[model samples]
Target chain A: MSESPQLTYAEIDRTILDTLRPPTGGYWLAIMALIMGVLLGVACWVYQIFIGIGAGGQNIPVAWGTYLINFVFWVGIAHSGTLISAILHLMRAGWRNPIARAAETMTVFAVSIAGLFPFIHLGRVWLVYYMLPYPNQRYLWPNFQSPLVFDVVAISTYLIVSSLFWYTGLVPDLAAVRDKATGVRKKIFTILSLGWTGKHEQWRHYTRGYLFFAALATPLVISVHSVVSWDFALSVVPGWHSTIFAPYFVAGAIHSGLAMVLTLLIPLRKIFRYERIVTMKILEAVAKTIIFTGLIVGYAYGVEYFLAWYSHSAVEIEAFRWRALGDYSLEFWIMVVCNSLVPLLFFFKRVRTSIPWLLGISILINIGMWYERFVIIVGSVAHGFMPHAWGLYRPSGIEYGIMLGSFSLFFLFFLLFVKHLPSISMTEMKETLDLGESHGD
Target chain B: MATDISVIGLFPDEQKTAAVIEAMSGYPWLIDRVHSPFPSHKIFDALKLKKSPVGWFTLAGGILGFFTGFSLAIYTALEWKLIIWGKPIIAWIPFVIVGFEFTILFSVLGNVLGLLALGGLPDFKGLKQYDPRCSGGHFGIVATCTEEEQDQVIEFFQNQGGEVTIFE
Candidate 1:
């Protein structure tokens, strides 16, 4: 265990608040770029809403297009937060202390972004409430048999519990913020903190409550992606109809989630001067976990192909054959190289430790995961059982623009979060220092 | 009779704070509260408080959520009488998904509710004696005592080399 340097209470408080100070010009420049992208995305959505679903690239066979791909991508990205926060904490991993706050924040924002696509995909957004099982004048209820309905339930539940977990964890740190803040800032933090006074009576219950939330959230992390995968797996579609999808999707989710966390944290640590707290040792541990998950994803890929051949199902074989050699052949090879081959570099100590290497590999994983969804959703639907109905589907400019906007929105939220809240958990970091001192680290 | 006032002792070291709690365990002064930046097992053992009952709330809520989710799905299916994929109205297998989702939803609600109800949270009015430094890195002990014992309380904190603040 590489120890973090001992930090005093005042020093920890000061270091974290310094990140909240007014941004430099570069910060504003980045924010403006993100805002422009977001605004462009909104304009595209408005135009689509007015001109109808034709503005999107959704055709007969490929009704689920880039919006669906972005949905799964964002949902997949949301997994790492809970994995690092709830799962690692339950397993007694001490290194998660300084990073859990940011990871959980990522989960919240990614899910928010993911939740939007379904509404965007709904052509008549006003009738979107038809998806709910409320007692309505029409007396129609959503079919529980549909994985889409399960998705609604699962994603919404994940959002609520994840938000609760994130906010409850923030209470102590928010109290710290309230103490250091002045005037209007203090009032906002105080209300957000709900009068957390660090009294033992509240701490006793608070600790227990946090533990329960973690336990509750752990299964949620697993169930969410499983339900998402079922959205494809439940169908008789050749490429998607497989038993391996749930665990496969879960592993891939963690793989991409870890990559995204590293992608965000590397620059964040450098920019905010948090090298001491977010040490290279912690980064290495994360990289090591990524290598393991990446291998699982690679194994899943090989098994998927092998199973299709072994079963001697003509339809399945044709789907795999087309995926490797047909219309989307370039995307297929790129995903294989990015997801399966690139991560193997981490096996060497040098690549894992180098910030540039880690950043490059992370961005590759993000792109690869998005293509993974694109290939699974579009590639399968593009060439169906009826070859006569099969046709090519390409994303239009509006599709590309909206996708760009989604990314900008995600980063914009992260920028605001980094600027305002304590990105690292102040209370937990102080405890780590105390624990280090007692153990003579 | 509302004759009780309290004095809080703040210390830079956790061991010193834990020691004060141990020393006052048998005293008449109520040592119902101690403040620290993080949870301390030593102070917890010294105070001899019971395990928090918050988990019970989660358990209760999870059970209710499961039933609520199942009932809703089943009721909708039965009432609507709509069948897809030629399946039966009460498809327990598919309903399991809805049930599982609500289980998490209600359990989280229970957890937050238990936190607020049992921990007495959101009390902006009652925090007169809270020292901000306790959140920074200090440990504090708050003891409610009669006015007559106020001097002894202050003396006790002084004897322990603590920074004392008395709240009326």
Candidate 2:
């Protein structure tokens, strides 16, 4: 952990509480804009439902397009939340104290948004319940042996567990908010807090419960993305069928996830004036971790090419070659430059510490990660086994609109989260302050 | 029957509150509960509480979840008896993935349920004695006493440099 910020317990409560006071005109305007974007996406989805799945640009050999790409991309974005909150907590990293709430909130919102893509991808959105394992008159149960089924189960579990973990951590802070709030707000928080009194017994069980949830979330986060990868890996498509897909996808997920964290948190810190709590030191540590994940992502790219050649599989070689130098080569190289090259800037201290550089590079990484999924999902399928079936794919305007809506929805939820709840873990910050004071004494 | 009263001692420092609890160890039952803005290992040690059994809840849920997952997959597969692509009727590998997800899902649910049950949460009664300052910087120790011992308890708290409030 970096040097503890000089903050009193009361000050911590006051500052965090101040963030929840009221939404300003600017905040409302941002909300209005996001809602408009969400409506546009919704309208496009409705049009697609009415016109049939043919409304999108997906065609034979490229059956999976932007929807699947968005699904995988958003799922990847959710990974760093668990990494920062659960894994860091287990490691006892104190720097995570300030950012953990936001990351975990991001996880819940991102995963929720990611959950929508599969449904949107299902053109007959109404019959989506067919994926559920229920006995019906038709006597059909979802194929447990299928990777898609695995995704449904894994992602649902991830959402539930992540929600539980996030809510568990929020309880004490909710109680603090309840205490500070009045009238309707107090009643609302009182109910939300479930009447938390922070008694010794409550704390004892609460601590144990939080630890258990974190422990569960660690493996759950890993498995969720692995299952998402299996959706492609289990296929016989040349570029998709790789044993290294799980770890490669996992690394890429965290890489993008950390970038998204910076992208959101940098602006958040500036707006909320959380500079004291979310110190530069913490951001630097995050950047350093990004470098590690980024290298793994870069290494995965090299290994994919190496293995394609090393295996001497003609189809795999063609699939990879077409990815880099074919119709979608621009996206492939962009993914490479943005994900692998952009993050390398963090190796320079000036880049890591500079907010503009960090924000810019992180944004590039987000774009790169999105394209990374696009390359892997669309690029692989577009040029698979049968040379006669080889074709190029491009997203329709509807697809683009829907993707825009998803981004707006994600930011909207995050905005609401910051305004309604304690964005920082007030209880944890107070504990840190108390400990720091004692140490100084 | 003698009416019982509760005397609440609010301390500014958690360490001082913990010390008071330790000094009054001979009358451990007198310390009804200690409330703080954060979890205090110091007070927990002074009180010498037992470890929580929430993990057992997690273990039970995990075992149940594994069986539930495997059974659901196996029964459904056998009921159909339909084979796909020459794959086995009961594929354990894919079923393991389902089982693993369920195990985590149920375990987390169990952990939360246990937390609520063991913590006696959703108890509005506890809030009556709760000082909002406990959520800020103060540490409050609530103790139960007989009418005869109320003065003695207040004096004890006052002697420990605590501000005392008596509730009848």
TM-score of chain B of each: 0.92, 0.93
Q: Estimate, for each residue in A1-441, the C-alpha lDDT of model 1 and write its tens digit.
A: 446556677877888889988899999999999999999999999989999989998998999999999999999999999999999878867788878999999999999999999999997898998998888888898888789999999999999888889998899989988888899999999999999998888889988898888898999899999999999999999999999999999999999999999999999999999877787778888889989998999999999999999999998999999999999999998888899899999999999889999999999999999999999999999987998989889998999999999999999999999999999988777766766521123
Highest DockQ against the true fold, candidate: 2
- Give the CAPRI class of candidate 1: high
Taking the tens digit of each residue's C-alpha lDDT, what string does model 2 give over A122-200? Answer: 9999999999888899988888988999999999999888888999999999999999889999999999999999999
Which pairs clash in the backbone of model 1? none
Relative to the unseen true structure, what is the C-alpha lDDT of residue A354 in candidate 1, on a scale of 0 to 100?
Answer: 95
Which stretches of candidate 2 lie above 4 Å from their native place?
A1-5, A435-441, B1-3, B27-29
- Candidate 2 overall lDDT versus native: 0.90
